[model samples]
Target chain A: MAILDVRDLNKSFGGLQAVKDVGFRVTAGSIKALIGPNGAGKTTLFNLISGVLSPDSGTILFGEMPVQGMKPHQIAEKGIARTFQHIRLFPKMTAIENIMIGRHTHSRAGFISGMLSLPGTWKEESRIRNRSREIMEFLGISSLAESESTSLAYGQQRIVELGRALACEPKLLLLDEPAAGLNMKETAEMADLITKVRDLGITVLLVEHDMSLVMNISDEVIVLSYGEKIADDVPLAIQKNAEVIRVYLGEADA
Target chain B: MTRNRHLQVFLLIAVIIATQLATMLTDTQHYLTQLTMSGYYALVIIGLCLLIGYAGQISLGHAGFFAIGGYTSAFLTTYDLSPVRDKAFIVLLSRMGLLVSTEDLYGGQVLHLHPWAAFLIAIICTIIIAYAVGGPVLKLKGHYLAMATLGFGTIVYKVVLGTEGLGAADGISDVPGFTLLPGSEVSGKLSQRITNYYIAWGLVIFGMVLLLNLVHSRVGRALRSIHGAEDAANAMGINTGRYKLNMFVISAVFAAIGGVFLTHYNGGIGPSEASIMKSVRYVAIVAVGGMANLWGALVMGSVLNFLSLRGYFGSYDDAVFGVILIIIMLFTPEGLLRRDLFSDIREVFGTGKDRGERA
Candidate 1:
């Protein structure tokens, strides 16, 4: 069964239709990649699914529940977490601290308990800290734990963001252009990481422009162009789809 | 990290204890009273630090909450309207040993509510008012939030100045001092300068401990996340709007508590207490201390307030504060303590390279 389902989603900013009649589905525990040219509204669709922007008219379902119209935090609480296309780590915080914030939903300690330094609050806090460190270790960035997030290298920052989203313990993860700016080696590592994430039983839905990375790691690829889905198929079929090829080549020609 | 926090906690306790001993050894009532006033300011400033430092929400009208607290206690303890005097609630309170009968200047019998009861009532009222105001006001970002708080402060100041029953521009006077134990033969008014000093500083210590613990907790991380990036914080399953409003209300409560105790200590509250200038002065203190640094705010708030009370700036208090604010913003916008100004000086002297390598 699909973990995420978007049906006939529509969104516009002013008169420019950013996402129009967009729809897709990601089966539970599968790796899905969304690939499109610059103006394809892939990020817009990601935003819609993550509840950053509401659709003008559509339904978003995470499992059996409708997620459209829910706030971003509400959607996150419903077991969906996302990383930004642009890195958005808390600049002044340590990398580990940034990831621990992702554990916010799972932790139950609140203002009063925190202020009093209750035993339970401390226990939960230590648990979160330990878990966050474990995540950093898994990402192979444990050495960067104490470093300021903004001071890290671009690839390291991307890994930190991924670690942060993973700390949410989401059933479904959305990665928005996770390898937008990286060398070939970094992109290869990111692809390996995405595969590792999917192997952990979390459904992965990612939007990327790098066709090589998408075709290599994605079990299914959804292609979008000019705010509409142009092709939805396996990576091999998407590579041969005439319309998807035309959109990419047309952008290259122009 | 745990060891560092423990050390900090130890240092904080030591500082509070040393301050207490110093006041006792000096035995100067006037200086003790001045320090006590600084303590009140410290309570409000510490709350402002949490609001500005962690939540990154600016409030320029905290003095309005302070005024509300002062006037609430002042009016309740001093004024005896005919309706309120005869109310069943008042009679019940008197029966319960919470209110006492006292003779007014006109030889009329008036029911005087216990100062402790009045203080609690003032805190409750301030919280309610803060909730109502913070809900909408906290939504505004940047200068808009500042402007809204400033307008709220001005409105409160105008209302206090125009209300006849509240003593108009002269403000309410003769607010009663609180007794620790009511309806007891040993209970006496907490009117001594030394007693007031300890009470004020003791509250400050409590506030500091609470704030320090909060900053190290889960909620504190959420607040810092919000400050770092509200959109990202919301995306991380944090209710950003709710947290912002909560901080705003909490900061207001702190200010109100300060106002209540200070009013009782001074025996009066004036319209100037609610002035916009006073609110700006608080924001200035927070900025001067360092935004997002709790201990820095406490130290700077108390020290600056103490200096001001000593008449060092005299009539130029506002002007001096403004200049300090401008200088801080221009030179070290991060905050005084947060910026390593000494390192920058060393760099200017061309010795920073060697020092940096050694470190």
Candidate 2:
């Protein structure tokens, strides 16, 4: 099944074309990597899909539902969760509480009931706590549950961010440069984590600079340069394609 | 966390009771008047605390909401409708028991809307105004947000000062007391002093319980996340705009409630109540109380409002508040009553920490 289908998406800032007529598709439960050189509209495209930035004109179908112009929260409710290229954790909150926030889509205690401390809210809150803990355990960071988010190491923070997104139990997960600040060992662990996330039957679309990580875990890869798609194929084919090589390594004659 | 919270609430109840008893024993029951007034101001502070502290939004127009509540009830209850009493609609309102006939200063029977009706109208008006204003104002960030709310306060201040029917510069006077029950009415009567004190603090207690419940629940977490990082919260499925606006309205309603009760208790209100300085005082109190700490906001709100009401600062009242704001912001942006400070104080007194959760 085509879980996400995009067609002719366009975005611009003033006279600069940030993204132009880019389109792609991801099969359900497959791992896909969006690879590009810097300034190639990777983050902009990710933002468009997550509804942080609506495209100038485009159609994004998440399981046949049009989500192009929706707000981020609305998109989130539609089961599309994302992490930032830069880590954005609630600095004051504990690790467990950060993950618990991801369960916001599932929890429904409104203002009146929340203020009144209604009987039903107690049951729901404990459920959120346990489920958030379960996600942390799965991410293998359960021991850091009570530690404040700002106190965590770089790689740990990324994992906690992933746990937070996973706690939403979304059908598709968007990871933006997940392995950006990771060391070689942490990068290997992150690759393992991505595959594990894929094994859970959730579609994964990630933007990354690490070629080895992208080639290792991704079932399919899409390459872009200067706001346009240059190639879309399996990882081995992407590596062998002359057009993708020119974009990454630059023109040899020049 | 649960046990600590319950203990504090019980301690608050005990303190409220003990203070009343102490005043009675010392033959200084008149102090309860200022205390009662402080309790009302505390209502506004606690609400603003939630909005500014938890929601990470600043509102300098809270005093405008307070004035709206005060002026609306005052205008409704004191404006004589005797000249048009015989009209069909007026007669119908009289028949429906929404109108009251009270003796004016000259001993003439003046007809007006009942205080209960006026209070309901005031709250409804606050809600409408808050929703309308907050929808656009909360879209701004930082200094822009602060300036917008300050402008709102100035507009309200000017409206009340210029409008003749709302008593103009002199403000509305002779507002009838609100009767919550047959025997218990909100008034400045000496005999009912103790009851009024409890009445005012009881409302504060209720507000505290409600806010505490809110801050510990799912909505509270979402608000904290919004404060820490709005985009992240939105992507986590928390509706930031709706939450901010709802909180703005909720806090505005609180300010309005304080205005209503205090106007009834004091027997009149003035244009000064709606001034930008009053709003700044509230923001300063919240800052000094520590922005995100509910318990701190409440405690500091009561003590400071009590001192200000009792006229300790006198001519330098506004200046004192301004200085307090600057000092708090500069010296301890984390606020004065941090956990570390409490621990340090405990150590100085040689008292062991009450409870330490494992890190």
Candidate 3:
């Protein structure tokens, strides 16, 4: 069975169909790209799958288990973590603190024990802190650890967001515009990090505006237009789909 | 090399204690006695710090919980009102079925409690009531929550005013003096007030330590996270609703604990015990001190209380209070205490500190 299966998924806001009857399968350990022009419902679909928005009508199965009504955090607990398109790091907190919040799910001790400096809870705190630091080092933002989020450059913030999502230790990592504001060097680093994240025995699902990054790294690509799936195949094959070319151009024109 | 934060804290505490002891040795001074009262006020402000500073919740009904605790203990132990109000209520449900005699409620005299017992009982009852009210009250956000709790404070004040048995507008008097231990039996009316002053300050110290430990723990971090972003906190697996409720209970318990001391010190209970003005004063104390900072609350509470006693602002004390809040709102919105005095000290010591750095 596929790791992620969305069957007949649909969502609407008032009279507008934000996402319509979209179906796709993400096999385990694959870099699957959901690529579309802006407002092609790419994020809306991610939101639905990640439990941010309840599907008006659909079935989402994560490893054969239907996950429709789960809360966003619950979905995260079930091994799915996604970064936001607009970069929603807890802006006031230090970057490391932001990552530590993501590591909250892993902390075992209750508040009272942790605060009282109880014996057992201290170990868990250090462990979470170390893990967060490790993720920061992995993302090459270790130097930015003590910096406030808003102070950091745009690329660094994106990396911190990735580090936060990684702190969740999810089986499937969803990247929403991870390369959005990154320069070419930073974009390459992001691509390399995505490859490394996937190599760490995790499935990767990404939505990106950078066609080069999408066309280059994605093993498979799913195309959506006007909330409907127009194509689903290997990236090379998707690159030639006529409907996708037309939709892409049509969106660019509008 | 990390600036010895604890050393600074210990030094501050040592200095305050030394000052307190020196004042006590100087004994006959009226201002010193009032300083002790200021300490008690600071204790109550700690709870306000937790609520407004840590939880980012606005409470105008904390005085209600304070009064509930104060009157409960005072009236129950001193006046024998415990039988009708507390004990009778318990018995009516469990032991005696639904039928309760109104006569059984009446002769429960109003003022005769061992101050310590009253304090403990008041705190417990206040916590329970606060928890009960907080569960529903916290579900409402922003100003709505404030108004709901403000209404509760008003209700409590009105109850205290209307109930003639509870001293009415005149308030209770001759609240027996303090006994540090169970039966040490300290005497003389003046000495009793003095003893009460010390005990109240001691409780304040205890409350401060407890609150300090509380806000540094996991729950404190959760509260801080919620304050930063409610949606983000929930998405991090925190039940925001539950945390807010817990904060409400904690804040109320603090106020109630402070009330216990306040009641014993004043040797009285009245409608003003739960007045909105009292709660507003606390809110101001927390605000001026810096929300979320315990020391801020402590220092600000003591300072404000001391100034009021001196009639520093004379007839315009309330106005000065209002003006202080406005200035704080306009100039230093994060609060005076929230600005990190430790960092300031570091800078003063010629150490280059990382200001505006968040990581």
Best by TM-score: 2
Give the range where candidate 3 chain B is weakest over 10 consecutive residues by summed lDDT.
B96-105
Please state every model's RMSD to the true fold in angstroms: 3.6, 4.1, 5.6
Distance from true location, Cα of B258 in model 3, Å: 0.6
The iRMS of model 3 comes to 2.4
Candidate numbers sorted by lDDT from highest down: 2, 1, 3
Instruction: Identify the CAPRI category of the predicted complex in candidate 3.
Output: acceptable
Tell the DockQ for candidate 2: 0.86
* TM-score of candidate 2 relative to the true fold: 0.96
Docking quality (DockQ) of candidate 1: 0.88
Q: Mind giving the per-residue lDDT tens digits that candidate 3 earns over A55-114?
A: 999899999789986888788778788888888777567898888878877776664574
lDDT of 3 at B164: 84
lDDT of 3 by residue, B7-61 (tens): 6456656856676677668874566656766766676688778888888888988
User: TM-score, chain A, per candidate?
Assistant: 0.97, 0.97, 0.95
Question: Just chain B of model 3: what TM-score?
Answer: 0.79
Q: What is every candidate's C-alpha DockQ against the true complex, given to 2 decimals? A: 0.88, 0.86, 0.46
- What order do candidates take by DockQ, descending? 1, 2, 3
Number of the top-ranking candidate, with DockQ as the measure: 1
Q: Candidates 2 and 3: which is better by TM-score?
A: 2
Off by over 4 Å in 2: A249-254, B342-359
